[model samples]
Target: MEFSVSDLAVARGGLCVLEGVSFTLAPGAALILRGPNGIGKTTLLRTLAGLQPALAGRIGLPPEAMAYAAHADGLKATLTVTENLRFWAAIYGTGGVEAAITRMNLAALRDRMAANLSAGQKRRLGLARLLVSGRPVWMLDEPTVSLDAASVALFAEVVRGHLAAGGSALMATHIDLGLAEAQVLDLTPFRAKGQGQATARGFDEAFA
Candidate 1:
């Protein structure tokens, strides 16, 4: 499968954040987004995931082909790890909870409650849902936030396995994910110019 973005523009709170962004990823490839904080990495990812509308351009992929993992873990604090996986599996109409658990190294913690797990473990559980999603494209935003060195390596292994199986990934992270062949997109140059300058137009007038 191939995923493409062309002349994309994203806005937050009705204010433009990024523009003129474009890229493409075929199966078995990965693209990493790099930029300083508030440069619209997360917004761009959200737009690509279809969580929000793009102000301009087109995305050449079916909405179902992409799965987004934002900064939030989205876990049910009251649910056990296994329960959480099963819940998402059923929602996505896919199964293989055992394989996902093993892939994410959550087998031992499968029965543990989400609220009781460490930050890294919880993040692992959150990422494990991606496998059950059965989507070809992964849109991740700072996916390694709470992971330690070992867990980071584990996550990389999981991503490698996905790519090997003909999946594509688009990730935004400040830390190195250890993917040697991944392409990088820096959003700094794409930031909307003169955004913070005082403009003659009011918010209501602009949106009107």
Candidate 2:
């Protein structure tokens, strides 16, 4: 699937957090959203995932074609790891979720309660939901948070594999993820503008 954000703006209580943000992603490509704290990175990802409404402009996404992984685990504390994944898989209409769970190295924790897991373990479980969802587009917010070096490497490999399989991704990360060909869009330029306004810079141009 392909996505394009044209002059998209997000507002909370009449305060614009993101303005005039625009970008496009074709199949098999990735766009990295980059900026310092509270510059609307999470808000923008939510807007793209349709969790938040855009105050103005257009966000073109295929209907039900995206999977969003936020910083929050979004897992039921009462459920076991396997149970949580099963619930998400059923919701997403995914068929082969067991394989995904195994690939994420959650087999040992499969029967463990989600709330009992460590922070990084919970994050991995949350990420495993993505592998099962099978959505074409992935919007991840701070995907590397709470991850160790090994887990981060695993995450990078998973993302690379996703790109190789012709899927698209929009990721907000503070650290380098070792993505060879990923494009970066800095949101700093858009943060200084007034409410209801927007600014955008292309990844190529910004990096240059």
Candidate 3:
């Protein structure tokens, strides 16, 4: 399976957010979208995931072949951790709920309420849902937002494993994730010419 965006444009409040954005992601590959804040990285990911309407261009993916994890954890505040997973598993049509919970180191908090978990814990739970969903493409926005160093490492490992298993990912992150062969797309160059400037160097500089 593959995901591609062609000449994409998105506007919000009558202002252009992204224009002429294009990329193709293949199985076993990943791309990191980087830029200054408000450059439309999150909007691009959301448009690709079909969560937002595209003003122009196209996003191609198989039916139900993609899964998206937004900045929000989207967890049920009133449900236990296990209950939350079970609910998502049913939506994803997967039966390995227990295995996923274990993989995320959430076994100890199985019966704990999701509302009571820390931010990092909630993010981990969100990541764990990807494993249980069995989707071929993952679109993650700030997957490591509140994660600690160890949790970030764990997330990197999981991403590596996903690529090794022929899955693809599109991620937006402010911090570096040590993944060999990962492609970086710097969106700063495409930002409005005179609006503001990105202090960081280009993608090549950042990756090199």
Candidate 4:
């Protein structure tokens, strides 16, 4: 599915962070968001994922066609590695656990409980979720966190495969995922004016 955002205004905790943000991603393509911390990168991703509403403008693409991966792994500690992938596959109606395990190089740890995995292992499992989501548009936040060089390479490979299969992705990260062809959207220029301004106390009472 193709994705587009037009003149979007994003807010977090009642504070507007980004405004007039716009971009598009066609199938077989990717878009990378680059910015420093506290600059609305995560907020923009979350807004696109429907975790929060956009303050203004529009996000094109059906909510069902989007799959979001937050910074957290969202794994059940008691479940095995394969079990985790299998569970998501069942939910998404996409059976690719074995393939995903192989893709993420988790076959050796397939039987290990999620709680026992290292930080890098947990991050890999989190990334494997995209494979089973069965959704064409991926919204990822800091996907390469905690990965080593080899694992990062594996991630790049799978992402390429996704694009090749007519899937698109929007990723927000400071580090490069090695997506050489992906379009970059820098959020710095769109930062909202007076983003952190606090409302005056007397104004509320006067209005009331």
Candidate 5:
């Protein structure tokens, strides 16, 4: 499946931060979103994931086709690593938590509750969710946060496998995944004018 965004405008704190952004991800491809901090990367990913509305323009994919990973782990703190993967796998109807656990190197930590896991462990488990997501287009926000070098390499391999299997991804990250095939999209050109000027009364949320 192809994932695409065109002439997109997005807001954060009720103010437009990015506009006129456009890109397309073909099947088996990936795109990395890059810019200085506070450049609206989160807002843009949130908008693309339909967690927040886009201020304007178009995104070409159904909600079911995309799985989004936020900056946070989004884990069930009370659930064990295996349990967490099972929960998400059940939701996505993939029923393949074992593969995800092994893929993310969570097999050793599978029985540990999310709250007991270290930051990097939690991050690996979080990325593991995407394996069972069964969605072709991944919209990830800083997916490598909290990971050590080895874990990051593990993640890069997982992503590479996904693309090889004909999946696509859009990610916001500072770390280089050593993915030579992944293209970079700098959001600097799309920074909205008067972006920091938040209004006391702003336009209603826009979705598309």
Candidate 6:
């Protein structure tokens, strides 16, 4: 499926930070969002994923069609690697838990509890959730955090496989995972001018 955003506006801490943002992500493609911190990448992604409403503009794709992965690993502390994947698989009504575990090199630690896993291991497990989601569109926020060089390469291969299978990924990150084919969208130009401080709770509340 093709995903698009046009003239989009989003707010954080009740303040408009991004406006006139536009982009299209086609099947089997990837788009990297580039911008400094506090530029509303997370806010825009949250709006697109349906966690929050867009202040203005349009999202061409339904939120249910996309699977979102945030910087924090959304894992159950008591659940093992395999258990976590199975839980997500059940909710998404998707199978292939075993394949996802293997693809992420988690077979060795499949039985280990999430709380027992290292930071990098937890990150790997979190990303594996994207595969079992079975959604064509992936909205990832800094998906490479806590990963070593070798592990980064491994995740890159997994992403390649997803694109090969006709899926799409939209990521906001600073690291280059060697995805030279993925297009970059710099968010600086679309920044909202003279935005106010976000006093209300939102993504930018910390900056208030």
The sequence of per-residue lDDT tens digits that candidate 6 reaches over residues 1-208 is: 9998999988887888998999999999999999989898988888888877777899999767999999788999999999999999999999999999999999999999999999999999999999899999999998999999988999999999999999999999888977766999999999998887662445443321
lDDT, ranked from best to worst: 6, 5, 1, 4, 2, 3
lDDT score of residue 196 within candidate 1: 62
Candidate 6 clash pair list: 13-198
Ten contiguous residues with the weakest lDDT in model 4? 199-208
Per-residue lDDT of candidate 2, residues 1-208 (tens digit): 7788899876544457767888999888989998887777877787677765667789888658899998787899999999999899899888666877777778888999999999999999999988888899999988988999988988888888899999989998877888876999999877736654432321111100
Model 3 TM-score is 0.89
Clashing pairs in 1: none
Better of 5 and 6 by lDDT: 6
- lDDT, candidates in the order shown: 0.87, 0.82, 0.81, 0.86, 0.89, 0.90
What's model 3's lDDT at 6?
A: 86
Better of 1 and 2 by TM-score: 1
Clashing pairs in 2: 19-198, 20-198
Give me the displacement of residue 165 in model 2, in angstroms: 0.7
Cα displacement (angstroms), candidate 3, residue 89, comes to: 0.7
Better of 3 and 4 by TM-score: 4
RMSD, one per candidate, in order: 3.5, 6.2, 6.8, 4.7, 2.6, 2.3
- Give all TM-scores, in the order shown: 0.92, 0.89, 0.89, 0.92, 0.94, 0.94
Give candidate 3 regions above 4 Å deviation: 192-208
Off by over 4 Å in 2: 195-208
Model 3: per-residue Cα lDDT over 1-208, one tens digit each: 8888888876444455567788899999989999888787877776777765666788888659998988888799899989998899999898778987877789999999999999999999888888878899989998999899988988888889899999998999887889885899988765544333322321111100
Kindly report which residue stretches of model 6 are placed more than 4 angstroms away from their true locations once superposed. 197-208
State the TM-score for model 2: 0.89
Can you give the lDDT of residue 3 in candidate 5? 79
